[model samples]
Each structure stands twice: as structure tokens, then as C-alpha cells.
Target chain A: MSPSPEQAAFPEAFAAALREPRSAIPARLAARPGVDPAVRFAIYRNNMAAGLGRVLADRFPVLRRLLGADFFAALTDAFIRQHPPAGPVLLEYGALFPNFVERFPPSQHLAYLADVARLEWLRHCALLAADAAPIDRAALAAQPPDVMARLRFTLHPSLAILRSPFPIVSIWRANIDPANPAVVPAGLPGENALLVRPGLVAEIHAVPASRADFVERLQAGVALGDATNLVGADLTAALAFLLSAGILTGFFPVSDDAARRSDPA
Target chain B: MAPRRIPSLSTSAVPASRPTPAGLSPPAGVGLRPPHFRAALAEPGAVDFLEVHPENYLCDGGPQHHFLTALRQDLPLSFHGVGLSLGGADRPDRRHLARLRQLVDRYQPFHFSEHLAWSSHGGTYFNDLLPLPYTQANLARMSAHVAETQDCLGRQILIENPSLYLTFAESEMSEAEFLAELSRRSGCRLLLDINNLYVSAINAGWDSWAMLAEFPQDAVAQIHLAGHDHCRDADGGSLLIDTHGMPVADPVWDLFAAIAPRLAGVPVLIEWDQDLPDWPRLVSEASLARQLAGNALAEARHVAIA
Candidate 1:
């Protein structure tokens, strides 16, 4: 016979105690009569605390490096206790960590840390993202002008945009790349990043703030003409960079009626 | 959330035909890590086969898959899962089952294995493998879950004996008996981890070799050899922790040497997951495993193998 819901409570209690240090070892777990469960139970505790700390550390190398080991470990303990992994694919773990860092009291002083973490997470995602085919320029050219205006793009699976009030691009570069000794400037100039993996490696481009509006609109699946109109300055370079970067997977023209349905009234 | 449906990379990634290399008899396998991708490809015959944790390759497509696609053309592959909590009180996650099945169908590896221990409960996956009590009810739960996994995978998977730290008072049967019955009931095979048996037996105060003598060897389909760490318990008593971070300790190697005769022709994997050495060093460990296993098979047949 399988465990009854009452019996099933045993593992539930065990898992609960694994997360909470204060809880006594599930009363049923045993060693020999003289042996204490504390020593054995500590292995599972360390596995969750230290094991998960390593996972989070691996995911955010730049953040870990920036905060130093002691601080990272301190923050990571709080992070793991609150956000243990929901599934087995560890690659997908730590998605909410950036937001956690944003609210985390200790990291609040390092205002740029969250965005840098966000950037690293994107790079992590890009490392394992699916292969995709970019839009065919020749095929796109054959479409009518009116149809092209209302067209929306299907971005690559790995594409992500991060806009921050701090110079995250320079911070990420200075810390991560060994050869690139480019020092971060003193003034906190806001930066926007365009991230997409062209092949095996994901590339980060620091985009002009003026074009941030255009990128945001397009990402929201806004029509091409409308997205273009949102930006005042010339977008020739930005458009070229995006088109050449393998960011757009495909494109489709949305009818006015369909567009309205997608948007809120 | 629904598991995203992505295009299958198998048809696109893998080559139509893979070349088989002639090698020394009875292969030794090594866990393929990112650090050794280039070396594995550069010298295909260095190790006879490669094993990977399927969870690491769960993504859609990338360099790891890129290299594996190329390496598959040169050597055989095995998928050892670390996440399918078959010993959990609850049923296996259908989404995890589906995703794992997708890889199994794509790779078509000869050996697939998971631990008898449960690593997830109440929807949260503990990164480390956790112990399962060996009660009749727990045994029934594990058997059903294993059957469900096999039915979904459409292939036989091996269950490994986890390295454990403590015994459960709730357990009504011995771990060996539980594993034997699990295989008998689930119609699955075993992937015996020699290091795990050594570590667990010592930690639980049982004689390691005596437990090995009682173990059900006929059910084994694969073998794993790894290292453990020795530490003092709170009471200052000796404790063995299965870290898989160190080189195969002398005792484990001795255990493997002793048991290799019983497991002739089985693929042996050297699993060093942490503090990885250079590729050449890891391959040497694989070579040693191959030599020990090969020598055993040779003696059994009374024929020398080069």
C-alpha cells in the first residue's frame, strides 16, 4: 500500500524541517541508539544552504564577485530560504533574484547591482536558448508598404532588453571581461541594453537612450510604423544593429481589429 | 505554466551516421563536463563512451548541444537524470517526464538511470538528493513511480543506490531488500554506484563489504565509481560524505576492483563533478576504470584483451 495522506505528511514534515533550521529533525529519522541525528541532518541542511548558494553563485558570477564571498553568502542564505528552486532544471532557477536584490536592504546601496544581475541572467538564458532563423530581408521587401507599417516582429527566443538608471553596461564589462579594462565613468548615466544571441555567445549592445522608446514599443509588439514614430531622432543605426544581430525571428502584419484586441481599451 | 513547445533539434543536430572506433575491450566511461568538450572531440577514442546529466542539457539548443551533436558521431552516450524524484511520495511530474522522454527519444542512449532517493517534494526541488525511508508503503510508492517513468520513457531505466547519511525508524525493510524488491516490482534495472554503497554503508554503521555481498547484483545494468570525503561527526565519530569532488579514494578503487569481476561488460563511469581536474587527468581515471573492468572480463573469459 502506498502512503495515505496522513502517512504522506512524513516527507512533508521532513521537507519542512530541511528548510527551517529551528525545526527538530523529523522525529522518526534515526541512527543507532547513541547516534544523534544532528550530525546527519546537517548534511541535508548544508546541501540546501550551501548547495543552493553555489547554484545562485554560478548563475550570477558578476554579482557574486562584486559583493565578495561573505556578503554574497549572507544574501544568498536569505535568498535561498525564501526562493528555493521550484523545479529540477537549475538553469531556469533564479529568475526572481534580480527583483529580490532590488528590495534587499544590503544591496540597495549598490543601486546598479540588480540590473547587472538582470543582464547576467539574460546571458545565462542565452547560453541554452533554442536556435532560430532571422527574418528574410528580401521576402520582407516584397510586402506592401501599408502592410509593412502594421507588421510586428517575432523576436528571437533569447532576446531581452534591460533599461537601468545606472551605467550597468560599463559595470558589467569592467567586471566580467578580463581583457576589457574599460573603467566605469563616475556620473551615473542611465543605460539601455539590447541582448540577443547571434550564435553560440550572447552579445550585449549599449543602445542610445533616444532609441529605448523604439525598442520598447517593438518589444511590446507595437506596429512598426507606430514604433518608429515614437522616436524623434534618426533610427538608421539602431535599426541596422537590430536587423544584423539576429534579434528578429520573423514578422507578421496585424490587422487594426486584431491590434485593438491585443491592446487594452 | 505550460511547458513551451519548441522545434525538435534532434533531426537537425545529429548526423545521419556515426562512426564507430575500434578500441581496447570493455569500455570505460566518464561524465562529460563543459571543461572537457573540446578534448573529448579532439580525441574521440580517449574514453570509450560519455555520460551526461540530462538536466544540464534540458535547454532548447546551444554549445553544449552543439558539441554533443558532434561527439555523438564519435562515441556512445548515456543519460543519467538527477531530478526525477521517483522515490517521492507523490507521482512523477508529467512535464518533467515529457521533457525527459523527449531527450531519451532524441539520444536513444543504451543506459538511463536515476537515484532511488527522492530530491523533490511539495513542488520544490532540493538541489541535492535526499534519503527515502525503506518502508513497504514507501517501496510501493517508489515502484509505482518507477513504472510510470518507464511507461512514459518507453525504455528501461536503471535505479542507483543513493549515498545516504541516516537510517529511518519508519523503515520496515533493509535498503538492500527494498532495492531488490523495487527492481522486481518495477521491472527496472540497477546502476550500482560503488562509491555510494561504500559511503552509505559506513555512515549507517553497516559493514560495507558485507552489504555488497547481500546486494542483488543480477539486476545491475551499469556501474558508477566516484569519491567521498571523510569528516568527523558532532560526536567526533568518523563519517563519509559522498561529495564526488575528489579523486576516487583507494578504498573505492579497491571496492571497484573487487566487484568488477561480477560486472563484466558493464559500462563504468568515473563521476567527478566538483573541483574538476584538467581533461587529461580525468581521462586517466577513465582509463584506470577501463583497465580494471577490462582485466576482470578478460580473466572471466580466459582470453587476453588488448
Candidate 2:
């Protein structure tokens, strides 16, 4: 009763059949009697394409709202067929969809669609990312000033830094939450933002070029002294600002010996 | 001077006891969706029970958990799992089952259910229920997996029939026969989805009623009714797609009315997964089933009165 080698290979055949249209199915499959295998097979193809499309839409609601339903549906179908689900979870299905839309021939005119999708994706990631307790203010206050220079900060799992050529945050906020006013300029050069889950809510923090660079350095686990030099060499002001905003969650206590070995400078 | 204060939740709250019931039959219930949580809680009504997917409640403490907790207090619960992968040829993923069991222990749902389709193969998770070849080998594998799941949870589970689009030439037995045999071998019950039966019947050119008639009557514990999309095949032939949006079609309701009397008051749920409507619309759909159930009860009472 074990499935033969041919039977085990059905999923591969199924995946192939899904990418091609009904007209593309082999004549031999259609010639089968009674059940009409071609007819049966087409239903699955549609389901596979439509199901993936729905998952992508769920991941990027603002993109769908902005692009209109019909356009997003077409783009989603194309992306899903070209790139089938790499994981069993639909939550993990559309990791590359935003990038796909960016380069897709038909969608090239809508350059900002991809950035809107990225914003939605960052929100999704923030929602499902692992939970961690924010750094206690008392712990930071307790650390001696001498050891503070070597503290390597750990960013929360939900933190994501993105810079886009369009004012994507305004675009996303305007479509999804209309309480915020629409982007008056409609088109603008690159804006930077941080996506983070502080409580249960996912918040978009609009940071300046300076803060973004500082966060990038700390995220790379660069020691405070070196990271300060990399960003602007004004550690005191930056540290005070980040701590006040609750942006720096926790810091790894790197001893003087370990710090010296890691950073010979 | 004010006393020093420490921030803490109610860490000393004692865990509640969970009640487990025996046998197959389920009470009438509604599928709990996210949008309907407020309406469900605010209104006063008699929905015999409620069911939810354990995957949606995986977080430790969140809004979803809060809703599930509130609903669990009011009605009997059923933990229907969507990601268990019981029919996968590979070993049943223990982590998924353990998480489900943890929910079971916490909520102590009256019933637990999963489908008889493989969703994961070679580590690629399709997330959609793929058809299984109803051969003896698959039956044996699924039986063992079901037994393992039941043992892990320390309770018997009801396995639902899948909605199939294509039939494999390699399948050795009909789906009903295979499911009946699986129940016999694995000590599991059945969750009969009436809409799926109708959809599969139309697509595969089989008798929907005959399919249900063949299923083991004693093994069936619950029923599902949902809407489907009607489409055409490659050769312009008719096909019914099991898309769980929209209202329950007329034919599905007719089938439920016909088969319900025979099953002796099995719990039926109205499932709408996509394009979800407002609370009243979904509730009205459930209300239709409740009306049917009420009619069945009235007829039974008349027979007793006679």
C-alpha cells in the first residue's frame, strides 16, 4: 500500500502544474475518463495561486489599499506563481513579494508599491517577533561610568531600520490610518524610519540621519567608544538622547580586557 | 515618606482546573473570529459552544489570548488544529502537538480536531491541505500519527475529512472508507464537513449523499457547513471550489437539513475564513443552522409526544 516512487513525486508534478495554466497541461492527463483530471487539476492551480495571493495581501494591507484591489490581485498572482511558498507557514510565504513588486515589469510605474509593502511587512514582523522585556532604567543607572564605554547594546527583535526614496511612511499612514493627514507633496526623496513593537502596538519612529546611524552602529554590536567615533564621536549627547527615548533597550557589559582585545584601537 | 514600590502582575494567581469530557458528540457552536470578539462578548445569546484554531492563540499574553480566555469562560471549547501535519509521511511534528496539548490543558476544550491531509513535505510547508492517496500505507501512517497525537494530549481527537480537488490514480480506497478504517484502527472520532463533501462530490463526480451514508455513523461527532465558489474546469466542465467565504449555499443547507436528523443532534459550526462580514451577518448564518437544529429538536419532541 506504500505509494510508489511515482506517487511520491506527485507534489513535484503538482507544483509544476500550478505554475502553468490549464491550457498548458499535457493532453494525456485530459484524456483520462470520468473524473476529468484536467478539470480537477485546474481547481488546485487556481487555489494555489489565489491562496498565496491572499496571504500576500494579508501581509501588505496598505499596499493593497493603495494599489487598488484588482491591480494588487494581478501582481500577487504573478509573484506567487514565480515564487512558490518557501515555508509551510503562510506568515513566512511573502518575504520576497515586496522586492518582486519593485522589479516587476508591469508594476515598475508604481515604484512606491514596494516600499509600502515593506512598511506593512515590518509591522507584520513586529507583531510576530519574539517578546522581550524592555531594559529597566534602574539597571542602566546602576552601571558604573567607567564600564559604560564598553557596553554593547542589544536591539529588540522587533526593531527594523529602513530608508526609502519615497516618503513611504506618510503614504502608508495616509492609506491605513486616515486620521493622519495625507502627504501634500505626494512625492519626496528618501525618508528614514524605525519599526518597533514597544508594547502590543507596532510604532513607526521617524528618526533623523544621526539617530539612524547611531542605531545601525549599536545594532552591529560595535563597542560604545568605537561606535561613537563611527557615528559622530559625540557619545555623551547621543547616549542621553537614546536613553531618554527608551530606544536603547539593554547593553552587554563588555569588560575592559575583552574590549581591548576586540578593538585594538 | 512613601514606601518603595515594585512593579509586578498577579504572579500568585492559581491555575484553573480544566474539564475533559468523554465520547464523540459535540454541541452546536460557532467559529470564533477576531473581528467578532467584541460582539460575541457584549451580546447575550445561547451559542451552545465555540471553537478556535490553537495557532491563533500561540502568544503568551495578547489581545487574541484575552478574547479566547473570555470566550472559554462562557461556553464549551473545541481546539481545532490547522498545522499539526498528521498525514505527512514524516514523523508527526511533536512540537506542534505539545503546543496544542498545552492549550488543551489550559482551556480543557470539550473536543480536539485536525484534518486528514498532508500540509508539509520535505520541509516545505504548503499551508494548504493537500490530498492524500487513500492507500493502506497512508492509512497505517496516519493511524499511528493520530494515536501518537491522542496519547500526547491524553484525549481522543476527531479527524476531519479533507476537501479534495483531484483524485490520485494510485488511491486504493475511497476517502470515506479510508477514514472509517482510520478511525477503527487509531481510536479516533470523525468531524464531517458537509460542504466539503458536496464540493468534492461535484468536482470528482461522486454522490455527495452516498459519500456521507458510507461514513461510520457512530464515529461522527461534529459537522461543518460553509460556502464554496463555483468555477469551470479546463474543458468547460463544472467545478465547485471550497472557498470559505459568502453565505452557505442553498444545496449545502438542504443537505444539512436532511442528514442532521439522522445524526442525532451533532454540533454544527458555520466557518467563514475570508472576506469576513460583520458580526450580525456571520451570526445570521449560524442562526440559520440553529434554526434547523431547533426544527430537528421540535420534530423529535413531537415524536415523543405521539
Candidate 3:
């Protein structure tokens, strides 16, 4: 339908008032006796910022704790102005927050904040990920031993592997739980986090670097033999951990030719 | 005031064969917040029904889904949408409509509702319920969108009146007229939010009682009561923001007392979305509403006999 002349101007004007800080209320809006158009518009601005800010705080609680409430409010305001939600689902609104923090000028001093944000984002995603039944151990053990080597496994939908140069896991843990005694040490080695939702609750486990490598390769659809070969760590222990955690939901045997054909360039 | 006989409106366009599960009655209820989930589930009879914003539970599986599924089995559910911009220039987003359809099918709520304001525009969704002009073109757009949404969901939905901060110079009709016309053209019902009516009237310098008198009460299927915050504008004029952070104000409760008799048996909801009180306090608010509704029904009956 063709936009009416009035309809054409209303949204454009209202949107400008919302986006531009303290922009004069559009000519289309009327001021009541006591309510100035500008002040009324400010309420909307505050509401938009505060609503999105609350969603950000809920998704990135550690970020909020790391940056005190006032600073976090300012950061969320900036983020809101730059990247308002693209859709109605607030749960999925902060996908780009981690990248935004990475490029954020003021946050440059806190180099590890972006990685921590990424970890939090992963946990948020895992919490809302699709539901699936875990593979039964007996069903998998019944397969032939030779087939196990060529077997390709499907990871549960709520699984994410995050590798960061900073000790993001320790930072997240310490910040999320104040009672935890694990202090984030300076000059510490990086950490790998395995995020999974085996049941209703999502959990992040700090895994060894080798296990991260093995899981990453397995997640990429590599067969068990290839994934184990790629990791120099104890294959049996990693396999046991994966099986016990119920991270592997299903597996299918693959022929050598099929595996070679499916391999990415 | 004498009892007004509301005309029997045709609500049969939407199928009514799928009755709500046994034991669920459309009495007064409260918006189900996360904090009160366990309490609400534990005491299913605490409220007549429960209202929820579908946007909060769009995810596939989680504690939210688990709780809502368990609650729906016992309590009558009402899906109140805060995301669908029925008044936007664009037709309702197809993907959002599909998700809403999925929710409606799964829950089979007693009633479904969305605001008569726009939240998204030009591909950017503002979290707040933004106001719009009540012009002919905008009215046409809103009516068409409402009809499309109803057809998409294969059921009737209610369009609610929004609390306003500013009015448009281009608006040619009052909010009541706009809502009545929208319902007339779209075959949808109205969710008369008395708190919103009071807030908008006070903000826009209109008479709340007059607006209530002109409201299309017969077309109303539900009523919402919530609290607003008192603030000052730039010129030191009073501004009431629909914060929904406090208990229902006395003035709003008075308005409810005035209108409840006319809207007998309509499901009323007490919405305390922010700074939510404890579960017992919230349920107490619903009890107050039930008492007021009961008195209204009795008054209407007395007038009928007289």
C-alpha cells in the first residue's frame, strides 16, 4: 500500500527523535500543556536504552559485574545506539556485543573483556539451544570395534567450544561467583571452555588445551580416528569425558572414500 | 449509573469448539513473571488464569519452556504479545507471525493480544511500545494488519490501547474512536487497559472518565490494570509514565471499580512487570480484582432486577 503523506512523515520523524540524542520532537508531534515534546521523547530514549540494557545485563552478568553498574550502563547505552535490536526476541539481541566490545575504543585497555563477553554469549546461546535426547551408552557400545574408528559423531545442539588467549574461564567464574576462591592470576596461560546443556541447566567446564583441540576437530565432523590423531593428549581420557558428559548425541560409520569426499578443502 | 446492555457481538467467527482444558476459568489473573513461576505452579487455583508475553518464551527449550508447559496444563493461559507491531507501516513480520502461530498452536491460550502501537520500523525494533498518529491512512494500515494477523493465526486476537507520552498533530480521531473503528473493520476484540487509559488521558490532557464512557466496552474481551510512575516534564508539567513497576494506583482502581460492572465476567489482569512484589502480594492484588469483579456482577444483576 502506498504510504499516506502523514504516514510517510510520522515514522521517519519519530525514529529520528529516538536515534538522535535530544533531537527536537518532530513537527508532527504535539506538546500538551505541561509536557514538552522533547521531554516526552526523552522518556522513550531512556526506556529504549534501559530495556535493552536490562537484556544485556541479563545475558552478560559477568560483564556487568566486571564493569560496575554505572559504566556498564554507559556501555550499554552506546551499544544500544549503535546496534538496536534487529528483532523482537531480546534473548538473541546481543550476538554482536562481543565484537562491539572488541572494537570499542574505551574498552581497549581491558583487552580480555571481549573474550569474556564471547564466553558469556556462548553460555547464553547454549542455555536456549534446541532440546535433544542424549545417545545411550549401550547403543554406541554395540557397534563393531572397527566401525568406531571411522565413526563420525554428532555433537549435541547445545554444545560450544571457546578458546581464548586470556583465562576467560577463570575470569568468568570469579566474576560470576564471588565466593569462588579461584583468583584470576596475572600472566596466566589461556583457557579453553566447553559449554554444554546436558539437561535444563547450561554449564561451562574448563578443559585442557588438548581436549579442546580434540573436541574442536570432532565438532568439525572429523572421524574419531582423525580427531584423536590430531590431538596429542590422552585420547582415551578425552573420549571418556565426552561420552560421560553426553555431549555426543549420535554417530554413524563413514567409508574411507566418503570421509575423504566430505572433508573440507 | 444504570446498567448498559452490551449488544451480543458475533464472536463465533473464530472456532470455539476447542474449549480451554477442564477446570480452567477466565477469572482475574496476573502476569506470570519468572520469580512467581514456582508459586503459581504450586498453587494453580491461586489465580483464575495467567497472562504471559509470548516473546519471553520464544526459545526452543529451557527452564522457561518447562515451567510454562507445566503451568499451562493446570492454569488457563493468555498470550499477550509485546513484540508484534500491529501499527507499523510494514505488514507484520512473517517470521514473527510464524513463531506466534507456533506458540498459539502449542498453548491454545484462552485469548491472545497485542498492543495497538508500533515497536519496530525500518528493520530496527525499539524495545519500547512507540506511539503513532490516528490518521485515516494509519487506521487503514492497522486494520489490514489486524485482519492479516487474525487470518494467519486462524483465531481472533485483541488489540490493546497504548499509553501515550505525546500525541500527533495529524491525528484526526480520539483513541477510543480509532480502537472502535479498528475493531469494526478487522473483526478483532479490544483489551481495555484501564491503567493505560488513565496514563494516556493524564499525559495528553484529556478526561479519563470521558474516554472510558466512550470506550467500545461490548467489544472488549479482557481488561488490564497496572501502575504508572509520576514524573515531571521539561516545563514542570505532570507526566505519568506507564512503568508497570508499582501496585495499581487508587485512581486506576477507582476507574476499574467504575467500569468493572459494565465489563462483568471479562478476564481482568493485574500487571506488575517491574520491581515485582512477592508472590503472595501479587496474588492478593488478583484477589482484590476478583472481589471488585464480583461486586460489579452483583450490581449489574441488581440493576437488571430493578
Candidate 4:
């Protein structure tokens, strides 16, 4: 029942038609004579684009509500046309939508949209990341100094830290929850925050600038002491903050022989 | 290419304990969502199966996982995938396939199914079930794709017919003919959507009855009933859109009644994604399907007795 080898060329052409609205065989095929096929095919194209646009709008509801419906519609259309889906899993369709909004010309006025999108994307990533049991705090405390040195701490899979200039949390809260004490902090300042799923819910919290730099270094696998010094005297506070947040899961200590082999000093 | 071997079985993804599919009756079941998890669990045997979207549970642990676990304990479950993109021109997505296989192993679902449309191409995902033109090229491609999917998942997958918006002038065959061909070529079963048949038929100006007649009933394993929306074209002509928000229209129900007699006890599922009613209301909608199937069975019995 499969199509013969001779008929296998239709898929390429069909794929093209699905991509470009006006790129199919002559419109007259639907109804002959230099008649307008656009009017007939236009409905299909409109429905396809509009339906997909609405999907993006829904996925990025906070973004849409901020940008207003009409602007979001135009942006969604352009994004879909330029970047059609590569697979059927639409759960990830808008992975780059936030970046698209940031780079979009009309959206230059709304500066915080991209950061908010980044936060949403990270939230989605955190939600789907591999689940890990919370690290054994008691075990960490019991390890000797030398054994702990080799330990490479493993952060919870659901942890993501974001730094943004705009008061994105405020904006996101206002548009989504509304009644949560609206406080629009002074103009867009450099902001750092973490998104972690401790239980089942993804919680977002702002991290101080020093803690952001320290955690970034720790996440890079630097020695604990060296990573601590990265934040000066606040190293203890930063490490405690991250540990208490349940972001650090477990550590893999380096073997003594391997440590000795790498000891250049 | 030589038919690739199916993946080895894994039990990590399926429920710890599940009854094998044996002499299972096609009892009425409502599409399971988070909102009704409590009510669904409260009433034992209220429904026969709980169908969950596998994509929603791809996460390691979350509210979605919590509800599915709780519901899995009390009822038989089915894994319905919305993102396999099995009809795409390229090969099946390996990562998506592995994740799905893992979930199947964990859940040990009684049945598994996916849509007959492609949602992704080139790296971008559309999130909507986009239709394919029924051409020889597409049929061959889809058949291979379905085979590939079954090979990866290590089980037979039922492919549901899609509700299309437009027809391609270059189509070499009807949608029903294409599906029939794919089923034969891929060795996969069919999940016929009578509502989709009616909707697509109305949208593309095809004869609904003729299309249904052409459908490969022998391959059918399940049936889907859902509501659709109506839109007017420039000429004021009506277009029935497969929106899945409203209640089943009367004409679609009539079509189902007409076709039910021919099918050999296909499992029926009522899907209401958008404008969802209260749990009882949705249960009532599924009850109607059970009622109709019951009536058909009774009529058959009467014939035998007579």
C-alpha cells in the first residue's frame, strides 16, 4: 500500500506548500481562470497563521498581555513564518519567542519583554529537567576537609538563575496575579534571580549581586574556597544561601591520586 | 533500510503494576485533566480508563505527574501523544521517542496513540496538529514514519485521523484512502475520529459517508468524539473547524450512530480540551457514548435472539 518510488517526490513539494502560504501550485487549480485563489486559500492561510499565533500568544500570555493583542498578533505571524516548527512537540514551540520579541523592531519600547520571556523559558526548563533527590546535608557535614575538597557539588536539576535589568518579577506578578502589592521599582536596573523547583512548583526569587557572581563561579566547578573568595567576605552568606535554597544537591569528590596528578603547585 | 529493531522493554516508565490488555471492553472514558483528578479518583469504576497526554507528563515530577500517579492507581490508563510529529518528512525525533518510550515503560499504559499530522519541521515546533496532503509521497513517508515510531516505542501505535482545514489540489488520493494505505503499509492500527471525518468533510467539500466508507475499518482500534467550531467564508459558506471546545454536534452523533454498527467494538474516548464543563457534565457526555454503544449491542443481541 506504500507509494511507489516514482511518487515519493510529493513530500518535498507538500512541505514547501505548508511553509509558504502563497507558494503552492497556481490558485486557479482550485477554481480556474485568472480568478483570485488568494481569497479562497487566504482563509486557510489566515486560519493556520492565526491559530498558531494564538498558541504563541497563549504560551506567552504575560508577554501578550503586556504587548497588547494587535502587536502580539503581528509579531506571532512574523515569528511563525520565519521559524516554522521542526517537530510536532509544540510544548517547546516558543523556545526562542522571547528573543524574537527582544530583537523585534516594534518591541524596542517594551524593554523588559525579553527578560520576562527568558524567565518563562527557564521556568519551563526547570519544570521538565530530570528530578533529583535533595542532597544529604548531614553527609556533607560529616565529610573530612580533604575528602570534601574533591567533592564536585551537584546543583538541583530544576535550578536556573537569571539576571535582568528590568523589574521583571514585579511586571510578571502584576499582570498575572494583579492584587499582590504592586511595586514598580525605579527604572530598569541590573537584577539577578534564581528559578528553582523545590517541591513541584517553580519558585522565583531575587539573589543579591554578590551571590549571583559567587554561585556562577561555584556552578563552573571552581574549588569551594576559591569560589568563596570570588564574593569576598560574603562567601559564607552566599554558600549558605544557595545550600538553604536546596539548589545544591550532592558533590563528587576528586580522587586523591587524580588530585596529586593535577597538583601543579 | 532494513527495518530497525524495536527498543528493548523498560518498566521504569510504566506504573509498577498494570493489567495486560486482555479482552478489554471499549468502555466510555473522559479525557483526564488536572482539574478533575480528585473527582475522578473519588468515584471508582465511574469510567473505564484515564487517558493522559504523555507530553504533559514528560517532566520528571510536578503536579501533572502527581495527578497521573494518583489516577493510575484506581483506573486503567492510556498514553496519548500529541508531539510525535510522525508525519514529518524527516526521521522521527530520537529524543522525543526515547522520552515517550520511557514514559510508556513507567506507566505500562494499556493503549498508546498519536495524531496523523506533523507538528514540527526543521527545528521549530508549531504546537498545532497541521494536516498533510494525501499524496503518494506523503503516504510512503508516513508509513515509514509510523513503522519507525512503532520500532522505537516497542509497541503498536494507533494513528488518529486529523481534522483538516483545506485540501491540496496536488493530492493523489482522499484522506481516508491515504490513512488506509498508511495503516496497511505500516502495520499500525487506526484511531478513527468520526467527528474529524465530519469536520474535514465539511471543510473540504467531500462526501462524509463516502469517505467513511473508504475508511479501513479492519484496522480501526479506537474512536474519538469531540466538538468543533463553525466559521463563515467570504461567500458566506460555512466551515466547520475542529476546535475541540464545544459539545458534539447532532450531525456528528448521527454519523457515529450510523458507523458504530460496522465497527467491532472500538474503544471510544470523549475529548474536551477548552470550554470544559464540570466533572459530572463531562462524565455525562461520555455516558452518552456508553449509552449509544450499549444500545447498538442490545440491537445486535435482539437480532441474534430473533
Candidate with maximal TM-score: 3
A-chain TM-score of every model: 0.81, 0.79, 0.89, 0.77
Residue-level lDDT of model 2, residues B238-301, one tens digit each, is 6787888878888888777767666645678888888888877887787678677556545655
Clashing pairs in 3: none
Q: lDDT tens digits, residues B129-170, model 1?
A: 888788888888899999999999997889999998888877
Q: DockQ for every model, please.
A: 0.60, 0.28, 0.66, 0.30
lDDT of residue B214 for candidate 4: 86
lDDT of 3 by residue, A1-265 (tens): 6856776677877887788885676776765775567777788888999889988988898888887788888888899999999899888899999998888888878888899899999999888887777876897889787888888887888899998889898888788975654344578788999999988888888898888888888878888988877555588788888987878887776675664565331
Tell me how much of the true interface, by contacts, candidate 3 captures.
0.73
lDDT of 3 at A183: 49
For candidate 2, the docking band is acceptable
TM-score of model 4 relative to the true fold? Answer: 0.81
Best by DockQ: 3
TM-score of chain B of 3: 0.90
Superior candidate under TM-score, 1 versus 3: 3
lDDT of 4: 0.72
What are the RMSDs of all candidates, in order?
6.5, 8.7, 4.6, 6.3
- Per-residue CA lDDT of candidate 3, range B12-38, in tens? 212111123331222688999988989
Interface RMSD of each: 1.8, 3.9, 1.4, 4.5
CAPRI quality level assigned to candidate 4 from its DockQ score: acceptable
A1-265 in candidate 4: lDDT tens per residue?
7855424433444345656876853321232223244554555556558767866875676777777778888898989888776655556667888888889998877688898888777877777676667778888889898766556666777888888878777667667653444344456566776888766677777877778777777677666756666678775677677777878876656455564455322
